[model samples]
Target chain A: MFLIDPILNVCERLGRRLLMLFSIVGRLVMFAFHALRDVLVPPYYPKLIGQQFINIGYYSLTVVGLTALFSGMVLALQSYTGFARFNAESAIANVVVLSITRELAPVLAGLMVAGRIGASIAAEIGTMRVTEQIDAMTTLSVNPFQYLIAPRVLAGTLMLPVLVFIADIIGVFGGFIVGVYVLDFNPYTYIQQTWDFVQAMDVISGLVKAAVFGFIVTLMGCYCGYNSGRGAQGVGAATTNAVVSASILILIFNYILTQVFFS
Target chain B: MKNFKIEMQGVKKSFGSKDVLRNVNLDVKKGESLVIIGGSGTGKSVTIKTILGLIKPDAGKILVDGQDVTNLGGNDRDEYLKKFGMLFQGGALFDSMTIWENVAFGLTQGQKMSKKEAYPIAIEKLEAVGLKESIAQHYPAELSGGMQKRVSLARAIARNPEIIFFDEPTTGLDPIMADVINDLIRKCVSELGATAVSITHDMASVRKIADSVAMIYEGEIIWHGPIEKLDNSGNEYVDQFINGRAEGPVKF
Candidate 1:
């Protein structure tokens, strides 16, 4: 009887937690829908979108570029060492190009952006929420969904692909530099192998993943910030949640997208 | 059959298990300055927020000019919202914008006026708030608390709104600065012929700006009367609140 009661208690607790998780996801989905609907309406702020583009896409360039470069270089070094043990060193270019284009560039850039842009969006909007700036916006007859969330979400969606495309090129260049300079490989042959082995679908899939990850990052940020609690503690918690949730979603979506594209 | 600019009938709101407002009933006349006085967490802010459609009441009807605005939505809500301006307690000016841009936000963004057209009006509003034209380009963060509050007031009046709501307009200010703000509020509302509703705990501000006063205690209006009758109000809660007495019907 005692053992059965403990099992029932555990089940009840698990059920409650599951309900809470579903509630949060439902609210997030509804928020995204409203934001997207507002984005299609009139009163579009091209100026705000431009500002967010600079913030999310341009400002994130250095960190994303650096991360992608290192990831690609590491991939090349690791693959060379691993394949050398199996007399499969000739396939190094194919592995490097495939990994960089299909996985590393998009995922790394997405993570970096989720950390940088996601945290900033949450902090800025959360502070505004706590300080009553969002309320002030509503009082002024401005739809915050249109004025605040739409521009940011739109920029994140559009700019992420661009950032990832740039990252893809830089990442490939990093792999090439390591493959040729460090590995003592013939640069021409390595380039030929990369061009021959890389498929258009691989790069396209990564860009698509980048776009989705971008949407998730900004949406989570807006959701967390808009519903932030009062004061500094609330804003700080929101910032942390935005980054953590965005990073997790990016990884989850990466796998799902890879399945859809390849599997 | 008095022409009420705003009316709340049995309006109640609760957050989770806590009741913030319970059966709140009030009325404001056209072009009248009605100050709602209460201690913190007494639902003074919630009452005004419900009127503005920022917070939906759990139950009851809110009528603005004889129209039920309880469930207004979509374009109707937007159009309805256009008639009023609100001054948030924290001087909620947009930090991203310059002082002039903050003032002109409603004009440019809400009314869709071009920047060229709105700039002059923004400056005009700023100047009306006793700020110089040179400060127009400065940001809200660069200003003092008093100046920022003035800018928020400027933004509120920029649209020539029919109704103006001030939430703790004189809070966090020195006595002289608070008086200056109170005077500005009175002058602005009178000049615009706007129905003004303000929430504050400051007796001095209440005396300075209120044509009529309503005292909220524990989410309900305990006493309401003309400004002149505040001192001699028969209600113990009102007397306790006004006299700053710790021992009264109002619990800590």
Candidate 2:
């Protein structure tokens, strides 16, 4: 009877935790619905969307570009070491181009954006929530879901693909520079090989992943921030949760997208 | 049967297991300024928030002008909200926007007025709040707390709202600044002829801004009457609160 009582207590605790998790997910899904719905309604803010585009896309160019370039360079160097042993050194360009266009560009760029933009969105909105700016907005006849969340979510979704496409180009260029200057490969041959092996579908699939990751990043940020609890500690927790959740969702979606495209 | 601008009947709200408002019933006459006074966590803010429909009551009816607005949504909610302006305790000015832009936010965004049309009005409201037109270019973060609070007040009064809510308007201000704010609030409410609902623990603010006073204690209105009756209110809670006595019916 004592053993049974302990087991029942453990089951009750687990069940309560599970219920809490489901409730959080449900609330997040509802928040996303309202955010997306507000996007299609009247009183759209094109200016706000454009401002977010500059913030999420243009400003993020440096970090994402730098990360992609170095990653491509490293991939080429690593490929050479392994392929040279099998006399397959000629395949380094193919591997770098394929990996960058199909996977690395979108995934790495998404994580970087999740770190930068997600944290900022969460902190900004969380501060607004605590200070009652959100309530003030409500009293002033402004729909916060429309005025705040819609523009950010739309900008994130649209701008990420553009960034990833640029990342793809810059990454391939990085591989080209390494192949021609350091690896002693013929520049023209390397270019020709990359051009031939890369398919349109590869870039398209990567861009799709970028869009999904962007949506997840901004959505999680808005959710965490909008539902943030009362004080400084709440805002801090929201920022952390936004980054962590966005990064995890990015990785998970990247795998699902890869499977859909390749498998 | 009285002429009421706003009324909360049996209003109740709870966060998790703790009930913030167990059964709050109160009303304000048209064009009257009512100040709610209470100790912190006694549900003064929650009471007004429930009235404004910002915090939904768990079980109650909130009526504005005798219309039950408890379940209003979509365009109905937006139209209902257009009648109100609120001054938050922390100013809540948008840090990203300039002072004029912050003042003009509801005008531009809610009323669909163009920025150019709203600009002069924003400056005018700022001036009305005793701010110079040159201060319009600066952001909220650059302003002193008092100046920011003034800007918030300007924004609140900019649209000529029919109702205004001030949450802890005098909090965190020095006596002089708080006195200045209290005076401005009185002037603004009188000039606009709007119904005003304010929540504060500051006795000075209450004396200055309130036509009537309601004292909330433990989620209930323990005492309510004319400002002249405040000192003589027989309720012990009101006596202790107004006197700032540590030992009383209200323990900390």
Candidate 3:
């Protein structure tokens, strides 16, 4: 019995951590369910929803656009360098547009938002949690989920697609500029190559991925913050956890979604 | 007693292994100011929170106005919650909102009153709490702690709730400010003819505001009597607690 004690201790610790992880996931699912349920109910706060749309969707446009433009320019240059060895330099614009629209723009935009909006949401809600404001709202007969989580989650989901749409356009334009101005390619040929290779499905799949990423980012923020432990330390932990978890989920889901749509 | 406005029977709650409230029982008569007094962390706050439907008891029945509220939910819970108001320990006013907006929250959010309709009522409540109308535009952070408490009180009594719960309404205040808050609490409760339940470790708060007193110790209601009978409670726990004794049945 004594000989097995160390092994037992290790197993017990591992088992406990696994149980805790499962419990956290369970709580997150329940929270998402309740938030979605509130979305379908009456007594909706349209004013709050509109404000969240602006905060989550409209404000995110700039970052998405900047990331997409730089990513497309880099993609054209790098693909030109790689393809030049094989005498396939003409395919650079095709590769740039495809990569930017199908992968880079959505993933980069999601990561950027996960860093920016996710941290802000978590900090704000975490402070509310610590200060007993959330409790006070409950006491005042307001559903905290309805007032807080639903609007943010719904706004994130609805706004990310629009941001990605604009990003896609900016990204292709960037590819055109880099190919013609920097790579010594014909502008008309670059545009034609981009238009020929990129299909409507490529754009639709990226938008779908962005929407899911948006949901993941906002949900993680709300969950971590809403369940924040206590005081400043807890809120700080929550903000960090929101950004980290959202970024991880976006990366993980990006691969999974790509496999689904492409494979 | 059918006349009891709020009653807790065998209320029990625990966080993990530690029991916060253990077999706690109490009752408040209609329109009475009942002050629950105890040492710090003696479950006084949890008791009132359970009554307010914030913390559901692990085991027991809680009745409000002769109706069991232990399992209230959905619209029923919302309707039940409307009968009461609470002033939190730290004066938990919404930091994101202005003083008037905080006061008008339940009015606009719960009662469905338009902001235009609720504006005058918010100012009126602020005035009733002795706050000037100029401060209505200021957020909670801009105010002094005493001013914040007063604003919280104003928000609490805005809708004239029939039952009001004060959680440490005077904890961080000086004697004068504490007494001022106690007076506001008493005045507001009386004006609405509302039943009041306050939990505080502050004896000064009890002396100033209580019609009845309950002392909780080690997760139990060790003593409960009228304020007049408190000096001669004839119980060791109450005796030690009120007299500020370090050595008695109350073990540190």
Ranking by DockQ: 1, 2, 3
For residues B12-47, what per-residue lDDT tens digits would candidate 1 score against the true structure? 999989999999999899889999998999999999
Q: Which clashing pairs does model 3 show?
A: none
The residue ranges of model 3 lying beyond 4 angstroms of the native Cα positions read none
Query: How big an interface RMSD has model 1?
Result: 0.8
Give all candidate RMSDs, comma-separated. Answer: 1.3, 1.3, 1.3
How high is the CA lDDT of each candidate model? Answer: 0.92, 0.93, 0.90
Taking the tens digit of each residue's C-alpha lDDT, what string does model 2 give over B108-139? 98888999999999998998889999999999
DockQ, all models: 0.85, 0.83, 0.77
Identify the leading candidate in terms of lDDT.
2
Q: Of the pair 1 and 2, which is ahead by DockQ?
A: 1
* Candidate 2 vs candidate 3, lDDT winner: 2
- Give the per-residue lDDT of model 2 (tens digit) for A128-167: 9998889888887889999999999999999999999999
lDDT of 3 at B118: 95
Model 3's chain B TM-score?
A: 0.98
